[model samples]
Target: MEEIDKTFREAVADGRIHGAVLIAKDLTGKVDFSRSYGVRSLREEDPEKRPPMVADTPMRVASCSKFLTSIMVLKCVEMGLANLNGGLEKLLPEVAGLKVLTGFDDAGNPIEREPKSPVLLNSGLCYTLTFPLLQQYRKWQGLEIEQGYDNLDQNFKYPLLFDPGTKWAYGPSLDWCSRVIKRASGLSAEEFLQEHIVEPLGIDSDNMTFELQKHPNMQARRGDMTFRGGHTFTAESSSPGTGVLQYRDEEYWHEDIEPHGGQGIYTSPESYAKVLWSILSNDGKLLKPETRELLFKRALTLEAEKSFDEYCEQFKAFVPGVPVPAEIKHSHSLGGMLTLEDCDGDRWRQEGNLSWSGLPNIMWNIDKRAGMCTIWAFHMKPWGDPICIELGTKFEKAAFMMLKQ
Candidate 1:
């Protein structure tokens, strides 16, 4: 733990990271280590004014929010409110009528046509929308559209990159899934999640809510957002490989949106760890054993798996800072990215581990086989910046060694 702490402090001192929260818990729901390091915001020059990074500091977990969304959707299934294999179009008619984006026209506008088949709920949960589709949605649905269920419904009018079930793409499928959960359960996604998951688990409401209201004690932390330089790192020279790049300043937190099923979560590392523990414990209180298995089991088809692999390769290249072990094969599960094998001879996560991260460099890995779950969180961007990934990897390695001891 000391080494891990030192690594975080060094990164902060060197201006690689602003602050971070790290947590590791073992099989029996016992926390092995939970700590925070660095200042909450580098922008605050006054040491007295800046908040010290603490375990309870709230962070926008970015895509990691998908895990909570998935759990709530699964809970809907457990309660007979929704079906896993049901047609997404049934809940949201916009999904059934989505088109496929073939290419762009002379004016640089998208050209789309009808899809060969309708997308199923199962496929929608795992696949994401293409960039063109998002752009098309903004074009058609109006830029003033808010990011809520209605906005998602309107965005569903955009084209699909591929026939939904034919290939897997990472997009806003879970966001749509959140919409489905809302329709099927007859409750707002946020309310349903609170009633069914957060309150039941005794998790802090402030840590899990979708509302963007600022809290006196739980305000979202600001990221460092600096640029790294080759010879001399300057704010303007910040590249993905270089210094921190701040995306959201303090003002960004004031803007609010409806609970995004895919990425709109604000939580602390300690609060989120409890959700992981529930899965590792397999207590049958939140989900049945069979349902829990669905989370780690390979949920993608052979063709879909191929598509996922290709996308990941491109994704790795796009974000050079994030490291993916070459020996590891990945498949999509209902919960998140599923590891098919131990890439580094089980030096860290075991095979069948469920892992994913948020856009701001927050990461988590649930190694059910090892009865361990670890989370590393910080509010920094561009996602997968090398410094943040290295810190996370170092912490993971240290955690595994501590477990062995």
Candidate 2:
């Protein structure tokens, strides 16, 4: 824990990040480490007004929302309100009706045909917004997507990259899952989370929500989002950063946007840590034992696994921290990526453990073997900021070492 503190302190002192929160806890609750470092905003001129970072500082957790959404969807399964394996046609006709893109026709028009298979609940490639056709169509339609769900219609209009369940492609499929939860349970995504997940876990309602603006307490404590100038993965020679901090939209999306299952949730690291610990410990507080097992189970087909592997290999060049080691055997879990066996690196990650990252350099690890989970929270541009990754790696290594003791 002291090592983690030193790592973050040095990072702050060197101007690598403005503020960050780190939390790690084990199944037995014997090892609980939670701390925050640096200031929330460097721009605040008044010393008293400028707040020091804390465990409850709100952050727009980006794709980390996927992991949280997965939990809510699993709860729906426990209540018999949703089925994890069933086709999504009934729940979300827009997603089900999407065609598969074959290629382009003459005159550069896109060619699409009916899908060869049904889009299952776990099919990550069913409907993606990243496809060229989708992007073209979005531009053509003048689509203004401020929220994850706002892209639903455009996603429906676009073609699927491949037949559903045949390959893995990260997209708004989980956001569509939010729609499924809404239709089946008769509640907005935000309300469902508040009533079931947040309340039962004893997390402060204000600390977790899709609409941060409405929660004045949490919004007031919200940290500023910053980015390193001239530092991007695509650059020919990427440096950690130029040391000049440029600010991004602190509130990334419009406040009026609907709650997206894939992204846009504002939550505190301390609050999120509780959710991960519940899954890691299988505490039966948020989900039943059999139901919680889904998070660790491999949900990818052989063909899909191959595509996922290739994607990971190419993705490694873009980010310093690789969630899935390209050389290691891996597969997609119901919630996130699952390593097929133990991996030795800065730290030892166990087989079948689930993990993922947020867009703004946030990362989480849920290790069942070590009976522990860890989350590193930072608000920065470009998903894999080198400074955040380096310190995050060190923090993880320290946590595992502490577990050994």
* TM-scores for candidates 1 onward, in order: 0.87, 0.91
Residue-wise lDDT of candidate 1 within 110-150, one digit each (tens)? Answer: 77887676677667322222354455546554653333333
Q: 191 in model 1: Cα distance from truth in Å? A: 0.8
lDDT of 2 by residue, 1-405 (tens): 776788788888877787788888887766789988988765565646768989988888878999889988998999998887777778988777777777666766667788888876677353332355556545545654222334445434455778887777776778777788899899989999898889989998889998776788886778777677644332333655455765556434346466668786888888999899888877799889998898998988899888777766766644323644678877888788888878874256888778987877888889888888999887776666667777887787788778777
Clashing pairs in 2: none
* Clash total of candidate 1: 12
Q: How well does candidate 2 match the true structure in TM-score terms?
A: 0.91
Cα lDDT of candidate 1 equals 0.70
Cα displacement (angstroms), candidate 2, residue 346, comes to: 11
Question: What does the lDDT read for residue 47 in candidate 1?
Answer: 60
| Candidate 1, run of 10 with poorest lDDT | 227-236
Top candidate by lDDT: 2
Error of 2 at 278 (Å): 1.0
**lDDT scores in order:** 0.70, 0.75
